[model samples]
Target: MTRIESKLQRLSQIEATLVDHPEGITRAELARRFNVHRSTILRNLADLTIPVYEEGDRIFIDRESYLINLRLNIHEIIFIHLAGRLMTSNIDRQNPHAASTLRKLSTAIQGLAPQISQFVKGSANTFDNGSKKQDPHYMQVLEVLTSGWARNQKIHLWYHSQETGPIKEYIFSPFFIEVGAFGQTIYVIGRLDPDGTYRTFKIDRVERIELLTEKYAIPEDFNPDDLLNNAWGIWFTNQEPVTIELHFSWRVAQRVKETLWHPTQRLILQEDGSIIWQGEIAEPREMVPWIRGWGADVEVLQPESLREEIKNETIRFMNLYGIFAGSKENEK
Candidate 1:
């Protein structure tokens, strides 16, 4: 047999032994069982994700780390079910780990409350297109990124960036992984080596990635909450925060006031049932799409630039829908 096949068979044997013996077999015992040296056993275990605990001279696998029971309440179980359903859109449909996680949660909940399980089944039928069918290549990159993050290792990536106008090679010290809403792409948060600053990169845009031997230590001051405190979305900026005020018509005022949109958001209700919403943001670009989503029901009140842009957007919409002809008034 080839060396690769021998290694694969050894790894499979080690995993099976570890699973059967939760108390764990020692390094010497493992080496003896596999008919290999202690150094060879260590080498084989390096790539595995299993947690090892050393008590005296005996090294054993900590099974409790992988086998956890949260003992979730009904509401929490339902939330997990919904989140797992949503995650199906981001991850590949054939992803066994994600499928097993959802199935285990469903089974646990079904045993406790069969009625809720029935409701979940009925609700799941409504979302036939929930699985967005992610690219297998993207999934492979994500796996490497996750492993790099867990190991705190540096990764060399050939990334396609429009800003640089080339497929540039970068060494990144990845610290976090951000998965956006359902169907949205995944992003990697890392500190670029030469620049020594945090930047977010889309996972799918990475053309190539190679995990390096060097490891990195995350900064103590790295706080994602503080970094994204004033920004409207993912693009965190250090520029001065701008105050934005919007007036929502009475028709959509209640809907607008129902959710807390930002950390600095304030809402004032007028006597006519309209709402004056105000917030401070670092980047207005992210809010543009959300503002346009309201259409004629909302109007930007402060920040003349945003107001003008919204007016221009409305004019463009009118031109497309044939509401305004190619007339001088519409042009003005």
Candidate 2:
């Protein structure tokens, strides 16, 4: 086979393997599976023209393109286009920032979509929390997202998220939507367990957002209100609540007081002018450093247990690293 043809064939094989197993298949394993030397494997990687993520030695591919390439059947592509189009008008993808970001993305997914007719077939009305320009393409995404949300359905989405690592024959799934201040992002935040734990999968991060034909009925009692309310920041979870208390210096107290940390938070202003900020929390490990951002100006006053956890973590961090304070005594 010609050099280009060989790479194409091998790339197709890798795509098949991933289609069978979306979790991931490693590089060394890829070399072994194809009976190629490590060097040939490296060359194939370079010439394949597929994107992958590498953290140290582990390589992962999102499951997006798997089905698309597997079928190579026009009918399937047409179906994807039609289903994407049939989605109600309210479906929204995390609209990208108006910059080079969107430009790069629009360019990438150019050929990934099957056909325009599939999407535009069902007219999707467009409405949004932001400006309403009525972009036809954006309208398609909105329709798809809204359908996924309303039906409690899943979809295979094309997104860019942190988990996606190369071998891009593709993975796509539509499930939960990550809603943040800027807009909707390509992530599905849903329950991972019967006990009400949530795990989020990023849309673009994975190759495919395979919208399951099976519909999921959210238990009537599942209330995301508490879990969302207790978050320290964007990182959310359904973990148990921990009572965390923070003491703030007068200097930073006012600014901190004006904001709400959790819906359940209560503020007690001490006679000495210190503020005790107490709340039910989800994740303490992430919150400790934010508490320390005030330097010596803030203290963890309550939940003696959490104070100990913070103190131990602080000591461990200091021991593992070195720092230069502008202080003369420390310099000496």
Best by lDDT: 1
Q: Best-fitting candidate, measured by TM-score?
A: 1
lDDT of each: 0.77, 0.56
Per-candidate TM vs. native? Answer: 0.72, 0.44
TM-score of 2: 0.44
Candidate 2 lDDT by residue in tens digits, 106-162: 333447753443233222222222433434455355455556565555455544444
Evaluated against the true structure, the overall lDDT of model 2 is 0.56
Question: Tell me, what's the RMSD of every candidate?
Answer: 8.8, 19.5
Error of 2 at 53 (Å): 39
Alpha-carbon shift of residue 74 in model 1 (angstroms): 3.6
Model 1 weakest lDDT span, ten residues long: 123-132
Compose the digit string of candidate 1's lDDT tens values, residues 234-321: 6777678889999999999878878989999999999999999999988776789889889778999979998998888888888786
